[model samples]
Target chain A: MTTASRATRNATSRPGGRSARVRDQVLEAVQAELADTGYDGLTIDGVAARSGVHRTTIYRRWKTVAGLLVDLLEAGVDDTWAPADTGSLEADLVALNREVREALSGDSSVTLAVIAASFRTPEAAEALTRFWDDRYERSAVVVERAITRGEVPGDTAAARVVMAATSPLYHQLVLRRSRMSRAEADQYARDSAAAAIAGLLRH
Target chain B: MTTASRATRNATSRPGGRSARVRDQVLEAVQAELADTGYDGLTIDGVAARSGVHRTTIYRRWKTVAGLLVDLLEAGVDDTWAPADTGSLEADLVALNREVREALSGDSSVTLAVIAASFRTPEAAEALTRFWDDRYERSAVVVERAITRGEVPGDTAAARVVMAATSPLYHQLVLRRSRMSRAEADQYARDSAAAAIAGLLRH
Candidate 1:
């Protein structure tokens, strides 16, 4: 399907009215603009024009450009929930890493753009915090399950496990100065998962 | 000591001519600007005016604001290295983490400002890569020594361990909305060091 069609489908899937639709359109426009022009070049007027929404409506929902961008990130980025009982902690963790890798690599432009803008805006920082916190919460459930199954120590801090498992992928994205290929992502996922499992078992 | 006295002393320590002093003054002015106005508000002309150095002299050493800023970061940030000879991996790791925290909390506005600017500049991104790699190399010595001493598994990747020890601070600086305080930095260092040691032992 075309990108616009996919966005339309996504918008329709959510329960909302005309205002919500306008918001979604604006967000979609913003994402597209980010991919095309990057964070430094994205403009509110351009988003208003592309979304076919009134500037007043955009302003009402998100007062600042940073605020609008943060809202878009919150709405568009998919949060990975905890893995189901895979009968083994290793299997569950691998599944979790795969999901994170897919999410990061699939929409990398959006992620990078948000990161670029985040340096300048408090709202963007808040969005990033929410994003990381959501991932941590979901991954924590898997770690907690491992502890319950006696695969890991009962007193393990699940959040640290999650951080250890996913930090390398983030490091690659922001600090490595290179795009993350699928193969590289897979390797990072496997290695980090193993390291986290090893950590948990030791405790 | 007064800032000028320190600068004069540094100038006398180096074997450079008047031009070098001009460059140093301009760079110092840029650092002061970063602390006062932040990365977004920094300007080349402002540095020249603040330092009473010619704009041409400033541009001669560093091509752009980003380049100048990156140089400032590289010059200011010391490699906080520690040897892993404590016999126990956990003890070694705690010492390493303490050093990292101390360096991060020190009066190093140039490094912090450059990190902020990296979110916007490709040049800054490249500089960040080199900076992090240098840091990793220093931390790697500790990890390698641990492996040789049988405190950690021989197969352990020093790069991963170093990254884990450092990632949380960067994560907080970039993604979290809250300002990282000394207490938080200390807690993170302790927790991360403990978790990494536990993981190493498991392997």
Candidate 2:
């Protein structure tokens, strides 16, 4: 679950216990450090100081920088979006498009930094792959729902269709150094759904 | 012009010219250095030593690491492919796809390393932007040719069509850490053309 829900759960089950508080503080500190200093500049001592947590505790729980970042990314993957159960496939894909656009555009540089780091190291690569896999799996539900509603073919590759809708945005943001306007994102969504309807994403 | 054509021109016009030879060696050294030790580890001194050219000449001509790389990348942008005017839009887009796939898969890691570096530095960012713009311009011709041949609509965005055909391969290679076969490339081409023909790419 996302930190917001996790916090809610902590309040009900444990009433602001020390361990839950520590975890919240540490993760908050990590987010701040990632924003301020970026991935390369972050250090355990800095995080410990910022979080008011002990170095031993941080090291014992997270073995390396990659480990910490991986956990942070995993924590980020908790689903905050669901496919629009709208009557039409076009509208549902557009809803899915906006969800992805908002998520990436928030703290865009920080997200890009983590992605760039993934290219340089195997540990980071694995973590980033897992993060993307989680996203694709979540987005795939949208396609599956559309299929079940009889809006698309049963044998369509859900993730591939999702990738078709979103890859252009990612490409523009990361490599082309451009932002995807809402209009552009909507167009991409519509085009990708049209392609799926044309049976391009069939299994 | 690309290195090969530049070398050929130099040989015929000014045979065995020292300046042309020096230019060739310096760029060759840069490529080797980029492959052996990534962008961060490369140094002018190392390139100068490897190329057997004076440090002063290297500094005077290229000035900085980014300068050398930018020049090298620009040299790589010379036109080498033409859209197969095979009277079928499907054949033309497929041909364009193979060109991109070959260029990218040749030194995939090195290309990604440069792209990753772009996110961190302004100089690298400019070079990478130019590199992509050149590729897009070159490929846009394919779409334009198809339009002239009355294959696609006049209002279709040529570069966007090209981006559709190639962006997934880039996403898979760089972010998803996946390999793409020739079959996959061909499929992407066909799907993108199908989308365009359906009027999805029309402006």
What DockQ values do the models have?
Answer: 0.37, 0.61
lDDT by residue (tens digit), candidate 1, A44-84: 88889888888888788788788777776566344223355
Q: Summarize candidate 2's per-residue lDDT along A11-123 as a digit string, tens digits.
A: 23444578767766776677677767777787889889999999899999987777777766665554353456777767877877776566456453456656766756677
Give the alpha-carbon lDDT of every model. Answer: 0.61, 0.70
Total colliding residue pairs, candidate 2? 0
| Cα lDDT tens digits for candidate 2, B55-164 | 99999999988887776665555435334566667777787667656645644245655665675677877777776766677667777877887878999888678878
Off by over 4 Å in 2: A1-21, A77-87, A106-108, B1-20, B77-87, B106-109
The alpha-carbon RMSD over the true interface for every model, in angstroms, is 3.5, 1.7
Q: Write the per-residue lDDT of candidate 1 for residues B1-203, one digit (tens) a residue.
A: 00111223344356678866775787678768876777888988999889998888778878789888676545433323334457665556556655544434433444555667887887777767766666566667777776677656677666666666666555555444335565545444444445455544222
